[model samples]
Target chain A: MTDSLQRKRVVITGLSVVSPLGNNIADLIQQVFGGVSGIKLLDAPFVDQLDCKIAAQAQFNPADHFSKHTYSMLDRASQMALYTSIEAIKNAGLILDDAVKPRMGIYLGTGMGGANSLEEGYVRLYRDGASRLKPFTVLMSMNNAAASAIALEHQITGPNQTFSTACSSSAVAIGEAARLIRHGYADVMLAGGTEALLTYGSIKAWEALRTLAEEDVDDLGASCKPFSANRTGLVLGEGAAMLLLESFEHAEARGATIYAEIVGYGTANDSNHITQPSVNGQASTMQAALADAGLSPNDIQYINAHGTGTQLNDITETNAVKKVFNGHAYKLSMSSTKSMHGHLMGAAGALETIITTLAVNTNMLPPTINLIRPDTECDLDYVPNVSKTLPNLEYAMSNSFAFGGTGATLILKKVK
Target chain B: MTDHSVSSDKVLDIDEISKVLAQMIASKMELDIDTIKADSNLKELGLDSLDTFDLIFNAEDYFKIKVPNDQININTLQDVTALVHRLIVAQKQ
Candidate 1:
């Protein structure tokens, strides 16, 4: 497709996050750039005997933040998403009229849906009986609950979907939402992911992988180190982000503040491992996104690396970036926002995109905190523990490659 | 994955089990540390029976040891902890 004809001009009009770092996107950016680490020692209940006992808890409870009745109806993951979606839609100054409300879509991504509910139902059967099941069990447990909750809360009448692809879930949702808007499938799309898997099952699953950082061995803030020599593993975090994506024309028609232009998005399967990453497939996805944006590696300045900090992930990611940029890897200022918020898993893509969007808008890159010792194979300008302002850069890219070999990248450009 | 692959792994450790159990219980009750006592009757806590199911599910995951249906009768917090301890120890064998 020709660059001109292929261009659908998707732009971020508003962004909001209910994240471990903070409750809103602007606050989250500040929290990250200010070097305020969200990782903390997991309290006793959450710290039973795991090797790693640190987490970036969202610090916001739906029951306290929203109506109790409303909270009861939605799963924790969906509740986290709804908080951000409401804020984002409002931040866009979108008091949607009937004309526009019907055209707004919601695409949400999640790692686990209503896990709490599923567990609760099982408990009921174990403790009580078959009759103890909640009437809304299936509705709450369905993966699309996040999207459905957003649509219902905001009265959005357009396409509603939930994408589930593990960690890449949200990134895929964001890209798909952009496609939907650009293709006139929807005018405004609330896109992102929400996750709160700090529960026993979720943490245990991660524990099985032996990936959770065990610095509760002590209060080590740098346990989330993404590409460093001492990098152990990711510190699990919880939360959600919602980005208001609309057609450039449509956004301008509504006089929305354009945060950043979604220039390109590319996704590819490694056809490799479910957990481990492949350098070739990762590089291919990055290359494809740059190509999709009609941008050469030279045109991009900052990258929000999908640096999970796990040994294999960081090494392979570092290799992918080097291969994709070749010699220009040194010129790029890459960072993992996960350093501040911990790994949000399904929500990581949406949260990282917000950081990348802000970078293009402010010309300042958020730093990768706790990156002290650089590993030999993983070498790059991972902006360490501080934000760097680069005035000349016009484009930023964010990458998210998840388990099951799903990898995705999105390129954003500064708006004139 | 029928979970046979789970127990066969050595990543399972003593310290890991406690951390997993703590996180599971807290997530179920949707409460902070103060409310989720190790010995507190899970029923007496603010979390109802629905919350207990989540606790059990998460416990199974954290330990990577299947909590059989017969063992799901966790009336007290001690029961939860003791059962988990037994299952986790058994996984080592």
Candidate 2:
């Protein structure tokens, strides 16, 4: 309605990720291009306690990155977030001087915050009969811990917030951050998600939900097969991904290397079931994002799908895509990076968005690895098993649908 | 509140209370028990406000006596030990 609102543009300037594939963004993109699978059979003592023993665990050691005192205060999720934030900020080359520090903020998302710490604390208290739990247990387990920690670490005094929207958490976070910039609330934001819920408690809970993929074969890497006929369900994963978003003018003025412009963000709730996703909800969200971007469905070239490898999710998402894009759905390329990275839970959308941005920036579409035996009902070109290169890509969309029937979509465009 | 009364014969002495308090603070701070002095200020021992609150909680659980808000202004290990001894003595009576 206002002139200021109409003129402001949000763009992603820097991206970093701490994933199962790798820590740095370049290595992660490289691994994805190589059609690598990060999922592995977890060989921990706790694996024996769960129905599903495979997860895309990050190959990172927090001790190597943090001091004993600092590490002791952080949860695994917070550590991953902080690590990625540092990398993202450095990559953006934006020095948070006193003038900029107050305006810059953080928006992080996590489904289960500090689950490992909570599990460890409960085990110590109930099983070990310890009289006193750790002092920082509450701080470490809070859902906003990562956001608070990042804000404190960077001294970001503006709009520090966290979203806990299950699988759609990070997508909502990135969407909200973009809105903030578009509304002229802030100039820069560290937006993304982190998750480290690989503990016994978390795994057992997911097992109870019956959503974990059954690992029948020895090679657990093939466990997650999104949009495939043989796909069982999603394998759990732990990681973090962060994007440094700034106003387009701010980035251009600072001579920042723009990755891609985040043009549209849309979010909607199904209001139907707690776990089951609604096709209408998914379609409407995608439609809303396209409408927000002021672009027709035909203009989009690629889509990073939220294919969770679940029987219900893949089919529902495929139908939703068909509904939203209509004829163009068959033409444009779409794939689920979750096949390679597994489900990062709240961090899934952030990583997928990063991958989608890379696809738009480099014109190289990452494949949905292990998509053998495509589902009959789910008929879409999934860029199956191998990466593709298409130069001068125009528009790409990243979709994230969550457990509480929340759906979010982000439309990104190549900054040519 | 649940009954936290200790028998007069089972009441803990100041020395025992001091030792437990020191161990609790040391554990919370991740410091060696031998390094924490009874007269040294908790702030000097790297116990921030949150650490002090947790130490008070652990002290209450260990002694099975409720620590009043007034006693939370403890600056040294002696202060905590003295407060715990007073609370225990009062509970016994």
Number of the predicted model whose lDDT against the real structure is largest: 2
lDDT of 2 by residue, A1-416 (tens): 22554758899998999998899987998899889999998857877777788999898888888765567689999999999999999999998899888778898889998998999999999999976676689999999999998888888899999999999999999999999889888899999999999888888889999988888486778889999999999999999999999999889998999999999999999887999998999999999999889999999999999999999999999999999889988999999889889899989999999999899999999998888798899899999999999886989999999999888999999998
Which candidate achieves the best DockQ against the true structure?
2
For each candidate, what's the DockQ?
0.04, 0.19
| lDDT of residue A284 for candidate 2 | 90
RMSD (Cα, Å) for all candidates, in order, is 12.4, 4.2
lDDT per residue (tens digit) for residues B39-76 in model 2: 98999998788778877876777677787777789899
- Backbone clashes in candidate 1 total 20
Q: Which ranges in model 1 have alpha carbons more than 4 Å from their true place?
A: A1-6, A44-46, A126-131, A216-218, B1-93
Question: Which pairs clash in the backbone of model 2?
Answer: none
Question: What overall lDDT goes with each candidate model?
Answer: 0.82, 0.89
In order, what fnat does every candidate score? 0.00, 0.13
- Judged by DockQ cut-offs, the docking class of candidate 1 is incorrect
